[model samples]
Target: MTVLNNTLTFRRGLTLKNRVIMSPMTTKMSFFDGVVTQDELNYYSLRSGEVGAVITAAANVQDGGKGWEGELSVASDKFIPSLSRLASTIKRNGTKAILQLFHAGRMTDSKVLRGVQPVSASAIAAERPDAETPRELTEDEIYHLIEDFKKATERAIKAGFDGVELHGANTYVIQQFFSPHSNRREDQWGGSLEKRFNFINQLVDGVISVVDNSNVQNFIIGYRFSPEEYEEPGIKMADTIYLVDKLADKELDYLHISLGDFKRVSVSEEYKEKSIMQYVHEKINGRLPLIGVGDVRTKEDAENTLANAELVAVGRSLIIDPHWTSKVLEGKEDTIRRVLADQDREELMIGNGMVEFLDFMMPERLR
Candidate 1:
C-alpha cells in the first residue's frame, strides 16, 4: 500500500498531483487544418481527473513532419485558439497538460505530406516499405528544423499547456538520429551516440530559451526513448544509459521509456513477459524521474512499476477503458478491460474519431 501511496509529483516550481500520467497516445482526431475536434476534447477530458498529467497526442511541428492524415498540428497560428480550448478543458479537470511535439522523419508516407520527401539524420529509409526514403538533412535545414521546434514550444505555451514533451521515441525523427542503424551521417549531428544526440540537445536548448524555464511553474520537458531498437540488434540498455546521462545535463524533467520500433511493433504479450520498465529504472537510478510506459493494465502492476520507477504511464489500457486509473485506485481492477492479444489492427480502432472526422474535413483524394 505504501507503493500506491508514493505519488511522484513532476515539478519545476509547482507540482503535478500524483505519479499517474496519461502517456501520449496518438488520437488522429484533428481537423484537416490541424485544429482539435470536439471528439478529441471529450477523449482527453474523460481521462484528465484520474491522471496526474496528460500529454496530448503527437503534434507535428512542421508541414513536412506530418505523418498521418489526422494528426494534430501546431504549424500555424490559426490552429491555436481551438488547441487552447482543448488544453483549458484538460486543465479544468485538474490535470497538468503537456503537448508532445513530433516529426515522423522517414516513417512518414510521402502521399500524406503533399509528396514531400521525408527528412532524417541521414539519407536512410525506415525498414518498412510504407516509410519513405528520407533526404539527408543539410546543415541549414537542420538548424531551421530546430527553430521550428522552438516556435512550436512557444505556441504550446500560448495554447495553455504546462510544458512540452519531445517525441524522441518509436522510430520518429529524433530517435532515427539517436539510433546508429538509421543515422549514418559523418557530420557533427551523426556518428557517435553523443553526436547523434546533438540535434535533440540543440532543440531542447532552443525551447528552454523561448519558454523561460524559471517562470513557467510545473514546467516539464520530457523525452521518450527506446533502448532496444526493435529494428536493429545493436541498441542495448548501455546505449540508453549513455543517452540518459547526456540528457540529464540538459535538465530534462522526465524520461518516458518503452521498447520496440516502427519496424518491430511491441505486442501486449511481449510487454507482459518482460520487465522493460525495471530495466530502464535500473539504468536511470533516480537521476531524473523515470516514466514507465508499456502494457501496464492492473493497479497492482501500476503500483509495482511505481515502486521501482517514478511514474507509471498507461497507453492502450486507458484507450480501452478511460476510467482505468480510478478503477485501479479503487481496487476495481476486474472491471478494467485488457487489449486482446490476437486483435486485428483495423478492429482495435484506438483513434477512430480521426477516421470518422477526416471524411468530412478532407476529400479522399486530398486525404
Candidate 2:
C-alpha cells in the first residue's frame, strides 16, 4: 500500500484512518432555501467513507453571505437538523466530516444576496469581471459576523460534524480582509498586515472558544488559504509566510494551502525557485499539520504529495470516481476511472449543477 494509507493524528487528538482526504467541492445540489436535499445526501453518501475525511462545500455562516444558489448554510440553529443528516451521511464508514464555512463577501453579487448589497472589509470591488463595489462593513457588523461564525461552529458541533474548516481561501470574506486589493481601510481590520489578520484571528479564537466549551471531544478546526493573488499589491508569498507564521502559534489543527497544482512554484517573482507547498511546508515546520491538494488523481500523485504534507487531498479525481481511495487502497488503481464519461454522471452521483460547472470549467476531462 502507498503512504496514502498511513494514518494521521491531529494535534487535538483526532486521528484519521488514512492520509487521503476528500477536498471540498461545490455540488449545488441543495434546495433553494439552503436545506439539505436527498440528492446532496446521496452525493456525499457515495463519495465518502473511503477518504480519511471529507471537507464539505463552503457553507455560509450568515444569510447575507450566501455565495451561490443552492449553497449550504449553518447560519441559524434551524439548519442543525438538516446539517445533521449531512454529517451522518459523511460519517458513514468512520470517515471524519468537516463542514467548510465562509462568507462570499464581495465575491458575491446583489443577485446572489437577493438585492442586498454584499459587504466586505472595505468598499473595494473584487478584481473580477463585473465585480460590484461592496458596502464597507461597520464595526458592529464585523463583530456580529464573528459571532455568526462562532454560532456556525456551534451548529456544526450540534449537527455531529467532526470539525469545521474555515474557508479563508479562494478570495472569500476572510481572504478579502487580508488582501491588499480588497481591504483598503485604515481601521483595526485593515491597514497593516497584522491588522488585516484581525478578522481571521478573532474568527479562529471564536471557533476555538466554542469547541472548547462544547461537550464534543477532538473536534478539529482547519484553515484553508490561497498563498498569493495576481493583482498588483495583492497578497504576496511574503504576506502568506507571515500569516502562516502567525497561524502556527494558534490553537489550530491544520493549515491547508490552496493550490491549483501541488507542485507549482511560487506565483511571485522573488520566490519562484521552489513550489508553493515547499515554501509553506518549510515555514510551518511541523508545528501544525499541513494538507496539500491540487490535481492529485493517482496513487503516485498522493504519495508524492505526502512528501510535503501530512495529508493529501484529492478533489476532481474524487468526482470522477468516488471509489478512488478504496480502489487505490485495494491495489485496484488500474481500474480507477481517470476521465468522466457521459454515462458516469448519474452513476458517479455528480449533481446536475456540478456537471454543468465541470463542463464549463474543465471540459477537457469530460467525454
Candidate 3:
C-alpha cells in the first residue's frame, strides 16, 4: 500500500509536516474588543497536532479596520501577550501558526466602529445584505493604511508567530482595491490593472520590509486571495495571475487560494466541495508553495490536491473533526466525517457561532 503522507516544503525554508493545512475559520469567539479567549485556544489546539499549519481567523490591523464584534485584533500592543499565548499553544501542539492580518474595509458593521464608516476603494457598500455601506478612502488614508499593515506584520513577529497571511481575498480592503467594481477611483490607486495592483504591491512591500528582515527571515509571509469576485464580473483569473507574478519576487512563503467574496455566502457552497488550488497551482507552476483550500473533507481529496499542489486547506471539515488530518494520514479514511451542504452553508454564513447549529444540522456521527 502507498502511504499517503501529506508533508510539503517550500523554497522559503518553511516545511509543513503534512499537506493538510487548517484554513482560517472565523469563530467569533473573541471578546467584543477582540481579545483571544480560552475557548479559541482549546479549539485551535485540538487540531494543531493534526495539520501542517493553522492559519488563524482574520485579526484586524487597525481600530478603523474592526469589522465584526468578535473578530480578533492585533491593532494594539496590549493584545500581543494573549495572541502570543495562542500562538505558543498551537506550536506546542506541533502545528506551525500563521496570523491572518486583515482590514474589513466596507464589510465592517458601522456599529462596531462607533458610527465611523468603513473604508474601501470607493464609496461602495458590500453586496452582503447585512453589510454596511463604506466610505471611500482618501489618497492619504490609503497610504497610511499601507503603513498600518507593516506595523501589524511587525506585531505578529513580536507575538512569536511563525508567519503572517495577508487577508487580501473575500472583498476585504485589499480585495476592494483589486476589484474594479469596488474600486472605481480615478486616481493612481484605481484606473488600470497595474494601478489596482498598486495597493497590494505597496502592502506586500511594506509587510515584507518588516517580515523579511535578517532577524525575521524565518517568518513566512503569505497572501490569501480570490481572483474571481463570485457575482461581480470585473475581476478575472488573468488579473490574479498578474498579481501573483507581481508578488513572486516579494519573498512570499506561500499562497492560500480561496474563491468568492465575503459578501457572497452563496458562492462559498460551490467552492466547499472543490479544490480551487488545483487551478491556481497549474497557473503558478510551483513558482511558490501553493495552499489549496475549499471543500476538502476526506483523505482522498487531500492526497489528490497535494499531489498537484503543495498543500491542502480544510475549514469546516476540521471544525467538525479536529483529528481529521491525523486520521487521513493513518489511512483511516472511513473515520473521516462527511459534512452536509446545509452545515457548510451555516458555517460560512453564520461564521463561528454556527458550531452549535451544525450539531443540530448534522447526524450525530457526522457532527
**Top-TM-score candidate index:** 2
- Per-residue alpha-carbon lDDT of candidate 1 for residues 1-367, written as tens digits (9 for 90 to 100): 5354355655465466677888787677788867898877877877788788898889999999998877899877777898898888889556788899988888887788786788888887788756567899999999999999888887887888888999888788888878887889888998887898788788878877776643556666888887666566345556776777777666678888764211122333444434656655666777788877655767766776776578878765676677787777777888876543224223433356544433332233122
**What would you estimate as the lDDT of candidate 3?**
0.76
- Summed over model 2, clashes come to 0
Off by over 4 Å in 2: none
lDDT of 2 at 151: 92
- Of 1 and 2, the candidate ahead on lDDT is 2
Which 10 consecutive residues of model 3 have the lowest summed lDDT?
Answer: 259-268
Q: Candidate 2, residues 285-313: lDDT per residue as tens digits?
A: 99999999988988888888888999999
Sorted by lDDT (best first), the order is 2, 3, 1
User: Which structure is stronger by lDDT: 1 or 3?
Assistant: 3
Clashes of each: 0, 0, 3
Q: Give TM-scores for every candidate, taking all chains together and pairing residue i with residue i.
A: 0.85, 0.98, 0.87
Worst 10 residues of 1 by lDDT: 259-268
What candidate 1 gets wrong by more than 4 Å, as runs, is 260-276, 337-367
